[model samples]
Target: MAQWTVVRAQHPAELVAASHLFDGPVSHDGAADALARPGHVVLLARTPDGRDVGFVSGVEMRHPDKDPEMFLYELGVDEAWRRQGVASALLDALRDLARGLGCQGMWTGTEADNAAALATYRRAGAQVDRGSVFVVWDELDGEDVPAR
Candidate 1:
């Protein structure tokens, strides 16, 4: 049995090794934003010998006309560690953190086609809410994306 260690990383540099597991636009800017917020939780999970294996991050959410909830910002487990319950363990930690903060429930989004991710969340007891997302990008002069 492989034991795991979960640690909160306040520094982005510590997270570089595990960045590829994350799905969306994660950079220094995103890491800075997450760590700067008091309501955000950034975590790294490692094997017993200190080899990083997975990560799970989330932000506390609020709405003017609705109850508070936890928004799971990211969850990533390396291909080498997929079947050992790393992702599920990370989610359990996130849920515990959310419960500690008095959140009513938690939510997360993923690409519709990611069966592994969907199964992971489903196994962790997360409910899927169907919704639509609309994104408007900053236009570039015929290039794919404007240089930032």
Candidate 2:
């Protein structure tokens, strides 16, 4: 198995440096904004040789009547690192961080057809809320959004 280190990204440079792990090009200003936000977090996983191989981003959500919970926004691993425990490690790291921050729980959504993702989350001890539906409103600017 390959060895890697996972660390919470502390600066925009760290996030921008791992742009390839994202779905699209990472904007430096956007990274800066996210890091500046009070409850946003980005975790990066890097190989022993310092190559970024994966990332997980999350936001801490708080409600007036409940304790804070982490909303896992996204997780990505380089194709080369899939099925090698990289994704599970990233999820574990995020869960640890959430616990440290006093979050009551953590949650994320993934397409039902994504078997790899489902397996990874299950391995990380996540319970599926099978009846929950994922809904989104995108491209409010009138541009047509492509289906994933």
Candidate 3:
């Protein structure tokens, strides 16, 4: 079984633990600061031994013309934990949090060919926006950037 945890930006230790599940190294303080910001949220899934197995991040967005909404930013599960209900649980936690904060609805986007992700989102009650195209803007080239 998996355990769910909601990490707030004010909780630095939890934020660091959640960061370990990401693909790259994350600064604990930076993560905490971001999490502390209005509308930011992170949900983590841990094993019985307390190892982080998955995590989901989201943001709350409010516009003058529309009610507040949640943007499910990302979701990831450890290879060994895939296909289980960890992802769904994490999403449910986020949804509950969003609702508590007065969000009208939640939304997330996934690649059309990513069957598992598509299925997971659908199971979580997100309607597929088939007509939408995901886009990204790359403002800088790696060659011109200084080493981190």
Candidate 4:
């Protein structure tokens, strides 16, 4: 069985680890600063033996032209724990947190080819919003960078 920890990210190491698993661990300083911002939720998941197996982060967003929402900034489970409902549990917890923070809904984007993630979100009862697309134009190359 998996156990969940709902502790504020108060240490560099903890936030660093969460960023590594949850969002590629770009920079410890930047990750810490970002997590300190308002309306951020970071949850870490561990196993009975105390291994940190997963992490999820939510960021509140209020886009000018869109409704208020909470974005799944990052959600990741270790390779050994995949497909075991860790991700789903984390998301459900995030939704509850969002609701408490006055968010109407939560949103996230995964690569179109990532069927596993799509399936997990579907299992969590989240339907695709379906109207947003990621478009990138490379000024240096003067070409459109297509989704990889």
- Among the numbered candidates, top TM-score falls to 2
Q: At residue 2, what lDDT does model 1 achieve? A: 48
- The TM-score obtained by model 1 is 0.78
Please report the TM-score between candidate 3 and the true structure: 0.83
Tens-place lDDT digits, model 4, residues 1-148: 3465434455566766555475455477876777678877777776665567777888988878877789997788888878777888788888887887788988888888888888888999989756779775548573665667
State which candidate, 1 or 2, has the greater lDDT.
Answer: 2
RMSD of each: 4.5, 4.0, 4.5, 4.5
How many steric overlaps are in each model, in order?
0, 0, 0, 0
TM-score-better candidate, 1 vs 2: 2
lDDT for each residue of candidate 1 in 1-148, tens digit (9 for 90 to 100)? 5488888887866666557767754688777776888888877888777677899889998888877789898787888888998888889888988898889999887888888888899999976666756365677566877468
Q: Kindly list the per-residue Cα lDDT of model 3 for residues 110-143, writing each as its tens digit.
A: 7789999999988988888889997875656677
After superposition, candidate 3 runs with Cα above 4 Å error: 1-10, 140-148
Best by lDDT: 2
TM-score of each: 0.78, 0.91, 0.83, 0.77
Between candidates 2 and 3, the one scoring higher on lDDT is 2
Q: Model 2's lDDT to the true fold?
A: 0.91
